[model samples]
Target: MNITWNKRQLELRERFREVATDLVAVGSDARDRDASFDRELWKELAAADFWRLQVPTGAGGLGKDGWDWLAAMEGLSLGARDLGFLMSVASHSGLIRLLLTAGTPEQQHRWLPGLTSGEVAATGSTEESGGSDIRGLSTRAVPTADGGFVLNGAKAHITNAPVADVVMLAARTDTEPGAFELSLFVTRTDVDGVGSGPGEDLLGLRTSPTGPIAFRDVRVDADAVIGGVGEGLTRLYNTLAYDRILFGIIVGSSLEAQLEPLVRQLETRHAFGAPLSAQQYMQEKVVSLTMAVEGSRALAYRSFGQLEDQHDGYSLSASVTKLFASTGLVGSGLDLVQAFGHSGYESGSAVERNLRDSVAFKIAAGTDEMQKKNIFNHVRRAYRSGELAPGSRGSGT
Candidate 1:
């Protein structure tokens, strides 16, 4: 795939880089230590129109494509150096896309402005019982006499829950146990019976506040349903298709950022009267990391192309991209720590923070094991259906 950025896209990416460097760099250590989200930085992002890049022009957004959005995200990740803040932005972007894709006209009209203008949003799909398993969700949404629904359940580890203005809540609306029985609702967080749990102090991404959200008989009219009743799974999977690709970019870019500074340090720092970069072992490690970053970029952009083209294998491609990129990121982070040695391990060091942050990529979109399982299932199904050549099953796709 030819992944070329035009003049306009390049310009936008540079602009994002500058803004992120200026706004997100300050007090990063303090914010991470305090486990606080930077509301002021968020305002700066809003003023720069970072939040509306993916929203369509008709809905008062910038009408940029997926590639442009990914580029901007990469720029921000490169400059920000704060994984928590990037997580918040990525979550907000995902919710905006979901709204644009499935929200009714009135629903979009009501929420798109605020959402695109930097008002935070959260997704409440994972319950305490199940992390990413939609089948294990127990949240219930029973229809009321007034044609609305009364939602009752809890969502755990919800990003931006404490400050979100709106939440995309998924709950079981039917008795039968299956993916299709679920429905997606745009629930206002301020409504009665909706409560947020205390913020969690996480190992990484500490600047992004995450907590549980409770829904005790939360009521919403039928108009709150996104897409349609029993279509939550479909909409969710659709959103994941894009989200996984963006995540690949996020991890890849962050790794690239970490790799660059380490490389510079290795080139300048001397050990045994020789630059660290002159060491054969260190050179090999840096070369491997550089290759990984490039490979991840290729996979991410290729997956983006597949999605844009609506390829039959886009889902499989996206999963592979996420798997490859996230694993590469974690590996590269380890390489950075090794290259920097004791200095890298020091408290408040960028390399140390990156090592802590890179780990979350493996668990965020889906775990490494989960991605492998998805790849295996998809390939197995294809092979059984005679899609694979006689001896091509073990060969790389």
Candidate 2:
């Protein structure tokens, strides 16, 4: 409940903000227009050790804790003002988190160096069946006689799939099953029988490379399995929770980035007989944006603390954070566009691009419906347990 960033966190935040503004934000518009992922910029961030913020020191990382990492990422998102690029960062961070959580020592030793050094990594979970319907995935991994497995499956609409150097894949492993049993595997994209499709042209987040990845009888040793056999569901959700938490953080910072432009527009733009700032409606829009920035960051920081402490309520908090952040971001995005009028609606304009990018927040980590379902389930449990009392500020934990 401290609710304040310490000096170390503040320093890291400002440092990353400067790095992102100098290296990534400069060409964000161009990257979005061309649907390009700037590998050079990505490398620059890696060189700056952005990915190592939360990694333990023994693991060849900076050994910073979760709060510090969150602060730095907040600055990165705010300064860069490129949700697409940050989306890619979220996906990559998920991979790093998964490895940190479930990877064996050898597994970590094999992957963490390259991963921490800027090698692009992805988690292949969503398939053609859709992200929400993970239970319906058909990707199969049949075990071999030599303590290995042959993987044959495809993941679609995966962030970083088109440009990933390594992938952590989830594949069905149960030969006889009513409910699917899945296992996670680490695979290199350059291996034989592995193929990646070209990036998809999307409505928003165009700077992130997102596409399909397929494994055709791709072979991996027993060591490739993450955590254990038939244990992917838990780990998958853990990684997802991390990503969902990230969306909340990104929403907070991205909205903060919009506030300045929104206020400037209202202050300068004129209509009728006076400046738009003279209008109460325009002032309300600014207030909405400010509220969203504060609300999302508060929820995100709370969820992050729970997650870092390994609290039981972490998952629920993450869901709530993502849901609220996505809703606020999209709503505020629309208000900003409306406040700026035609110029905001113009293609390539910051507000126009931001509004478009904000739409993906609802769909990316998990749909708004998914978060609602999670929240409802949590509430139902709390209600049944007589824990849903009035004036209780708990998150139904």
Candidate 3:
């Protein structure tokens, strides 16, 4: 199931593995204890340039090629038991990427270096009560006579809200409800009247900060508008393909990391005078796990390649890839729990962490149902256009 890594990718994986081992040791504690993100790991990863792995050299990152960056992230995610760490790093990239794509030169110069250096953390606010309905957002930023703007609204389920150095918030700037009037604003979290509090107590990824941020007459200069008004939704949705691709990569990586270790345990341990691996029942279970992991990796890698080639069909593939990776991987996780029995259920075991973390992936990039529904809608329209191809119809047909 493993893809061939180039020399450079191999080198990068080795480097990240060192950090991954350290993270695995403490990630479970942080997740289960409902602790805030671990500052120590954040500092070490930032110092190691791990935080800036994918950022452009123009912006002070390692400038790792697209494949290398995706590969390294998948590898690290497999071993990183800390969902919070993964979420924090991802939120950081989301903010940086949007700014780099949409920010003015002055804005990039002013903020990119700090983000790459980890001098400050970043987060995004796009999803809301309407469920990613950017056009329907209740949040607004209005013109002020002083030439600045007054912002008023709130964002829910924001990752890194408690410690974000900067946040890219999307707001409507015109009367059009469905067109792209949304503007992306890069605001300092400490702006007067801008505050996040009352963190939500969650069932999983509890280690990551998830809270509501309220903006009350928050003031900002014209410079606060990223890429200016009228371009926010464009950049925000543009980033989704890459983000969803990585989300798929991580799902494959995490489940495989947990499953293989348990397979070995079953291979050697005797059960009723025979190794569990020797029993037809256990053998069947192992085969199922193998298929799940391999299936996820195959779908993810294909999607990654499409992304690398800038293929036109990638957006649709990304939906399918993300949907399968998020859901199929969990079916494989059953092996870890069943093969190891009660030991797999222990809070200290990697299997336990995998079980807890797997549930969140569907919700992370997008829900499993959402992915299917979005792709189904695309397919439905494609069918009507006679572009879905002969026999290319989806099962919902």
Candidate 4:
């Protein structure tokens, strides 16, 4: 239950905050209006080694651990109000972790350097059928005689797909669709038959360009297979498990950023012949939001600690953290908007933008319903196995 950060973690947080401040200073609302991802800003982040934070030193990364990674992400989110930019960075980190964990040595050597250097990488698992249902994906990858594969499918709502250099694509290698039939391939976007659709007009995170990618007879060698044939589900699940926890911290940090502006407004803006902060209702709202932010941070840190400890229930813990933190973010965003009154509802306002950004968190990684289902299934299995005492009503191991 120790909640203290060491010197290194504190120093890293400060460094990330400084980088975020510099980036924010150069950022303009034009990026959001244009729905563009700033290549120059991404390069700045890369030069700062933000992309290398999760990578291993031997692989040309910063060699930081999970806690450090969370700290960096949280700090970056707190300093940079651009949720879309942060989302893009987080997605690249997830792809890197997948490659490092499941990729072959040759594959890692070929792709890790570029990915860690902030050359964008994307994951194409979500299809038009629905991202939540993996078993329903229709993307097919037929094996060729030349020890390669011809992929034909389209991925929807792919983050950073518009400008990604490499994509970790999921497709069905078997005739029948099921969990075991899926496989992952690292497909180069520059190859023939790889097409990207126009940028999507999303409600939020507009700066992080998103679009659909079509793979029409896209060819890749057998060496492109990640982990192995029929291992896509396993690899994907692992990636999401890690991503859910990390995203919790990101959302928590974003919530923290919203608090300061809110407090400033309350302290400076007079209402009913006094400052808003003097009102009991305003004070209550601030206290509630403060508690939510702190709770989210605690949950994220605890789940990460469980992961580092390799606890048996870490998967469930991650799901819980993601579910709570994302929903909490959405709630807190709404509260902040209400606290800001009319100014918050103005176009391009920070609170309005944050609300839009926070809503996406519920859908990304896994939806709120999906997390509930996962938690339910885990609890059911534990209870049925007598891991939980019949009347104890406790979360079983």
Ranking by lDDT: 2, 4, 1, 3
Report clashes for each candidate as comma-separated counts: 0, 0, 0, 0
lDDT of each: 0.81, 0.89, 0.71, 0.82
Root-mean-square deviation per candidate: 2.3, 1.6, 3.6, 2.2
Is 1 or 2 the stronger prediction by lDDT?
A: 2
Give the per-residue lDDT digits (tens) of candidate 3, residues 102-160. Answer: 67777877787777665545455544575444556778888788877788898878777
- lDDT (Cα) of model 1: 0.81
**Per-residue lDDT over 235-337 for candidate 1, one digit per residue giving the tens place of the 0 to 100 score:** 7776676777877777766677767687798899999999999999899878877777777778778877877777767788888888887778778788888
Which predicted model would earn the best lDDT? 2
Q: Tell me which residue pairs clash in candidate 3.
A: none
Measured by TM-score, the strongest candidate is 2
RMSD of 4: 2.2
Candidate 4 per-residue lDDT, tens place, 1-397, comes to: 5556778888888888888978842564677767888887887888888777767777777788767767777778778878788778777777787877787778777888887665888888898889999988888888999999999999999999999998988888886533348888887899999999987899998988888999998889999889898888877887787778877777777777778888998999997899999999888878877776787778778777776666777788889988988878888888888989988898888788888878888998889999999999998988898777767665423
Evaluate model 4: give its lDDT: 0.82
* After superposition, candidate 3 runs with Cα above 4 Å error: 1-4, 23-27, 119-122, 126-128, 132-135, 145-148, 176-180, 305-310, 346-348, 391-397
Candidate 2 per-residue lDDT over residues 69-181, each given as its tens digit: 88899889889989999999999988788888788878888888898887998888889878898888888899999999999989999999999999999899998858689
Give residue 199's error in model 2 in angstroms: 0.9
Better of 1 and 4 by TM-score: 1
Error of 2 at 149 (Å): 1.7
